[model samples]
Target: MPPLHILHIDASARPGRSGVDTRGSHTRRLTHRFADRWQAARPQDTLTYRDVGRQPPSPVSGEWIAAAFTRPERRDEAARAHLAESDVLVDELLRADLIVIGAPMYNFGLPAQLKAWVDNVVRVGVTFGFDRSRPGEPYWPMLPPDKRLVILSSRGDYGYDPGGRLESVNLVERGLTVPMGYLGLTQTHSIAIEYDEFADERLRASISAAEAAVDDLVGKLARDFAEAAKPSLAVA
Candidate 1:
């Protein structure tokens, strides 16, 4: 079986402690456990890490927008170079079989750096397309059919669940999941840990609960991988 590639991304700017830019905190813990399980399950598998918090690219510009939409063969030198960084990031995402994103909710939504990464990767004609002719079917995905996405989110407040008080205003889950679904990644799961109203003990408990959820998710992924590795018998 070919080795599965995991693209692990952490969007937190904080290295430690509970603060606004605490991007890497939850993800660091989750990814550490994920990597351990993945390596144990598939010894030959590779893990690629991308830290968007510490080094974030500038927001997309008009030139990048135009260049990204242009046909590769017809693009001028300047236009080709305009989207080089973004293109590279998108390519990394495309090559991965599984993606694990660690994002913290900031100002009721995702961080600016993570948003920029999303903009660069979720390009039309690349990750997705629009099919106007098919009535009521507005969009189509260009990504591979088998990729999976797992999101680990840390929230200051716990109000994003269905029928929750702040569900109407919460944009973090809705924003991320919609785009991921649009890209044909249907097997999506999330681990959300709320830290606002909890004391140190309670916060630790929440983290523990979230970690257990992650363990369960990892087990499922490993089982799926094992099943995929089995050879199918040819029918006469």
Candidate 2:
């Protein structure tokens, strides 16, 4: 079997993006730490990266939608060119077994940049398809069963988890998880760093917790990848 494929995405859009390598960007640091550990543990694994924070894809437009829905063989050269970026994104996603997204909560939602990337990839008859089984409305992910999504999120406040003080206002975390379910991903995981506005002990503690979670997740995933590569044992 081929090496496990991982897709890494960064979505924090700090002013000038100067904070990429600093503690100021909790999400970005978390993702990098995860990647570093994964690489050390499984050097053979493949990793592909897209930095939406620095260069976000254009928003999906009417033309993009039309081009995407057009039959593969029928789309003209112009349409194909128009959807070039989206096509690559969707293809990259299909090729990856594990997707790692680092998203910072902005006004309780995903950055517009990351949302645009999501819009580009979630194409009909591509990433997913119209569900023929149910009437009214039905859409099912076209992806296989083994794909997974892991999100690292940062927030300016705490209490975003279920039953937390700010859960009602929390949108970024839920938004990221729910969309993947729609995309047919069987497993989704999240590591969050909160209390960012405090810039005190709370923020420090949150970052540490998030980093520890990332390391643990990367180790487990590396082990799983190794196990998956080995052939299954024969039945007795």
Candidate 3:
């Protein structure tokens, strides 16, 4: 296999324009850390970045719906025009071996910009197939289940982890996993910096924990890709 292709998506509204702003955005920091770590380990590995927060892909419209459902050869020029951006988004997703999303929890859920990206990529008859004739499991993923999804997130509140006090209300992971699952991304991992609103000792501690997790996850992924990219020993 060639060097691993990584797609990095940043969904936080913060642009990291200023020194202070960049320092404050935990998601941005974690994403940078992961990208740098990967590149250091394997310079050949590719990284394609999309900042949805700043330049969000257009939301799906009625025309998009019609265009998506229509058969490719049958689609008119108007339909083709409607799905142009969506096609690009889906293609980017299909080309990646690893995907890293930097998400900041907004109101206990995913940011609208990130949601738009999800809506664009998880298309019918493209990323997923719907078979009405099937007795059960009508919707099946069409993409290969080989992608690794890493989510670097930050939350203003705590207890979002499984069995945590506020786990029931935490929708960030579910929001991402459900839609991405439709596109066959089952190898998922999340590292969240919680207690943002707290902005105190607890917040610092959360950031520390998340930073450690990022180091561990990126180290493992880099190692795997490096090993995979190595040439096998030639037989005599």
Best model per TM-score: 3
Q: Candidate 1's residue-wise lDDT over 42-157, tens digit each?
A: 78888888888887766899999888778878899999888888888888888988899887888888899989888888887789986578788788888887788888887777
Report every candidate's CA lDDT.
0.80, 0.85, 0.87
Sorted by lDDT (best first), the order is: 3, 2, 1
Over the stretch 149-187, how does candidate 3's per-residue lDDT look in tens digits?
999888888989999999998888899998888768888
TM-score of predicted structure 1: 0.88
Model 2, 1-236: lDDT tens digits are 57788999998875322135444577778888888898888788899999998899999988888898889899999999989999899889999999999988999999999999988888888878886787866887788778878989988889897899988988886777777778887688888999888888998788888889899998877777667778988999
Better of 2 and 3 by TM-score: 3
Kindly give the number of clashing pairs for every candidate: 2, 0, 0
Query: Runs in model 1 with CA error above 4 Å?
Result: 17-24, 131-138, 234-236
